[model samples]
Target: MTLDPLPLAQALIRCRSVTPADDGALAVLEAALAPLGFACHRLRFGAVENLFAIRGQGAPHLMFAGHTDVVPAGDAGWSVDPFGGEVRDGRLMGRGATDMKGGVAAWVAAVATVLDRRPGLPGMLSLLITGDEEGPAVDGTVKVLGWLAAQDLVPDCCVVGEPTSKVALGDTIKVGRRGSLNAAITVHGTQGHSAYPQRADNPVHRLVRALAALTAEPLDQGTAFFEPSTLQVTSVDVGNPATNVIPPSATARLNIRFNDRHTEASLTALLRDVLAREAPRHTLEVSCSGESFLTRPGPFVAALERAVQAECGLAPKLDTGGGTSDARFIARHCPVAELGAVGATMHQVDESTPVAELRALARLYARVIEEVQG
Candidate 1:
């Protein structure tokens, strides 16, 4: 019997499993995977619920990685309840519909269909689903991968079910992801009357100069499969209400979306150098979400490309552009790629996916499984 993705998708969407909260989402997935012969283990790490379910015990293991967690629905109004999981006019609407619950359901259905056809197929299949992808991410895929590695259960390759498709169902596949870095700079100066300009050191002016220097030029011209690195100043504030006095300090926050051409170390050094040259006395704090990583075009990537072509009829374009996903963590273990539904409204108010696309993605995943196993 073929698993109906729509029902499962709806079931998942209805969970309201906002990040760091399972809200019964993992339970739903466990129930589905159990009947399929998978040995499910619920792994909880630091307030996050994660599951590692596997069916066979052999080589050429293929793991499907995804997060059941969905971002906050926000106060923005919506046509349907964000957790309603309503199927309106052939569209499944909910929080995780496109960002991933739809993809996870489709993959589960694909596995069910495959097992039905070839119950005794060689090799193993596993699902590494996490409930912390939309949150701090410290307790999600990264931790799970470590646990799997400790048990010698790391898959030969992983396919993260992040919504990688841009316009069409199979138009793009993410082979890599750019790195992210955030920094906060605080410039200190003496507070004094604004009228006596010489008596006070205006930190705001120094901060403005530092920001201008940081944003004056492009980070790089980009690489072969990635776009140019970008830096944006997100916030600049003194938070002072007194108009006649200069504040003692000015703080600014900026973020960088960088490519593989740079590492967090190199970028951090560059930033520090920039501050030292421009505003020598300023204090700064830098944090990195993840460094850029690429699997490079190899045998594993080729297999994925062939699988996508065999199933979707369209040759997918290999891309590395996007916000970070679990693929970043998986890249550390083995080659990883992200391929799923067209994410037209991933985090929007009416996040949704068409029924047809969901099934097609399942077929695509099944084909990928076959290729990887071979």
Candidate 2:
């Protein structure tokens, strides 16, 4: 019997599993996979619910990675209850329809389809589902991966079911992601009256000059599979009440999305150099979310493209333009790629996906499983 993703997708969407809240979402997946003979292991790390399910062991292993956690549905404007999981006008309407409970359902259904036909299974199939992808992400895939590594459960290649398609279901595949870096800089100055010409150090001028040097030149023209690095100042604050007073200090926050051409350490050094040269009296703090990663067009990627071409009739374009995802963590374990449903409604009110498109995505995943272990 061919498996359909609609029912499972609806079931997951109804769980109200907003990040750090299991709300029975993993239970829903556990119920579905257990009946199909998968040995489901519920792994909870730091209050986050995660599941690692597998049917077979050893070589040619294929893993499907995703998260059930949906971003919170804000007040109003939703035609249907965000957690109702309603099927309205041939669409599966709910909070995670596209950002990814829908994709998770599709992969499960695809596995069921393949197993129902070939009960013995092909190679091995595993799933890494987490509940914290949309949140701080410290306890999700990154931690689960450590456990998988300890247990020697790493697959030869992993596919993250993040909604990678931009226009249609199979038109795009994310083969890589840019690195992300955040920096906070505080420049100190002496507060003094505006009338005194040389009384104040004027931190605002120093901060502006520092920022100017940081954004002076493009990080890079562009990379082969990634866009040019970008640095944007997100916030600047002085908080001085009096107009004549030169603030004691001014702080600015910046975020950088960089291609493979740069690493977090290299970028941090660059920022420091700018501050030292332009604003010597400053303190800098930096945080790196994830480094850039790319699963170059190899045999595994060719197989995925072939599956997309066969199942969806479109040659997938390999892209790396999106923000960070769990794939960044999975990339540290093995070569990973991302392909899933259209992300048009991800993280928005009344988020939904067409039932027809979801079923097509299930078929696409089935083809991917076949190609991976064929």
TM-score of each: 0.94, 0.98
Candidate 2, which segments miss by more than 4 Å at Cα?
none
RMSD of 1: 1.8
Q: How much is the lDDT of residue 314 in candidate 2?
A: 87
51-154 per-residue lDDT for model 1 (tens digits): 99999978889999999999999887789999999988888888999989999999999998888878877899999999999899999899999999999999
Off by over 4 Å in 1: 74-76
lDDT of each: 0.90, 0.91
Scored against the true structure, residue 319 in model 2 reaches a CA lDDT of 97
Residue 350 error for model 1, in Å?
2.1
The CA lDDT at 170 in model 2 is: 88
Model 2 weakest 10-residue run by lDDT? 115-124
After superposition on all C-alphas, the RMSD of every candidate to the true structure, in Å, is 1.8, 1.1
The ten-residue window of minimal lDDT in model 1 covers 365-374
